[model samples]
Target: MAENLEPTPVDETSNRINTPFNRRNFLKYTGLTMAATAIVLTGCDDDDDDTTPMAEGSVNLGTGDVGILNYAYALEQLEAAFYTQVVANAAFSTAFPSALERSILTDIRNHEVAHREFFKAAIPAASRIPDLTPDFSAVNFSSRASVLATAKTFEDLGVAAYNGAGKLFTDTGNGLTYLTLAGKIVSVEARHAAEIRDLISNGDFAKGDSGIIAGRQIVDTNGLDVALMPLEVLQRAQPFIKQTIVATGLPTQ
Candidate 1:
């Protein structure tokens, strides 16, 4: 999630969770909504320029093993937040039409929360990223299309993220351990991706170009799945994060 508050809250500001999300705002606001009316007073600025300035606060994900752990942690936070919203919404039952469908999503939600918590416990307090704010303003929790589509994006991104991180943990002694855990978690993400894709369209699960979609594509032609550098993953995931996710120090691919 983006970390800065616009000079003033406007019509479309995004937000994160409520357990004092301050690395930015602690409790001044809730959810991913802009107190648009608050900014209305500033509307009368006479300046001819109309371009919006980029947000200011930035969150560094750190470097080395810690950075990669934080990276995975950040993503789990996003997925957990998104799925939590889905299951809590009154429209949840309507969105999934079948008990099996609902249960699957429920299971996925639990899995995400577990993953999020795992990272929180695995990483040291000083190293872990703050609980992120999610900006799913464009998502319609009640709509089946919207929910499944968004789920697809998150699961697929999670898989690719872990895939790319594998090579970074090459500290042979501990590398195997990290890769093992990541492998186990990503396999779950892959399953979730396929499930969501099939829900979206039975045959659409692996239909996209190479690694972009949930298929067997690899870091290369061996068909292992796409591997995104930390920065690349951050760019794609940024829109959903209300907090700014800085990936500058992570190892480059």
Candidate 2:
């Protein structure tokens, strides 16, 4: 049986200074409630597709559109967990002394949590993947550079994952809904990637020769963002994830 992966509530009273842009404000300002309500109203009509059987210990991400949603859900779970830990760490204040930086990070945490919940509501319970455990041992949360670098990795990966997975949705009835939602969310992730890059270096947001975003290899010669297959994305993400995710039944072409 899979564990029900509920979003962990972020602690309001922490060592860091309180910010006005909390999760509630995020939902209200972004109209996330209405969006989620719409998903809930229309997300369950599609039936679950047949999934390939997985190894006994590994988790199967399901098949068809559900697999893609599960894949997104798994990634969101990781991002939300990472940001939650970043804001809650004992050295959070010392690592990021700038109030603006702290506020921005907090807002990102809120956005990620909302994204996680949105997928949870969008995918039917029977098709949703289990809560994944993250392995952040490689990350030195106390160090500013370490935290920012990890944030860059996550944000960039998220954008690329959505870009890569968008074409795989084949369900004519609900595919558009998922694709539109993905577009909206990926835009936010791209913003986060840009913000983190700028924070790392004043003008490193989208700098590259002839349009490619340098350093991360996430952009191409045509100025388009890199799109990776599910297996490839999972391979890059596996280090942060403890669970062995078997991404079967996802479209290859």
Clashes of each: 14, 0
Name the regions of candidate 2 deviating beyond 4 angstroms. Answer: 1-26, 33-57, 174-176, 208-217
Q: What is the lDDT of residue 159 in candidate 2?
A: 86
RMSD of each: 13.3, 6.7
RMSD of 2: 6.7
Tens digits of per-residue lDDT for model 1, 1-253: 2223222221223444421113223123221113321222122122321111124555677666667777898898899778767776788887777877887787677667666655665665645667677889889988998998789888888988998898886444422356666776888888888888888878766656434544545344565667787877888899998667777678997
Per-residue lDDT of candidate 2, residues 162-204 (tens digit)? 9999998764554346777788889999999899989998988
Q: How high is each candidate's TM-score?
A: 0.74, 0.81
Say which candidate scores most in TM-score: 2
* Candidate 2, residue 143: lDDT: 97
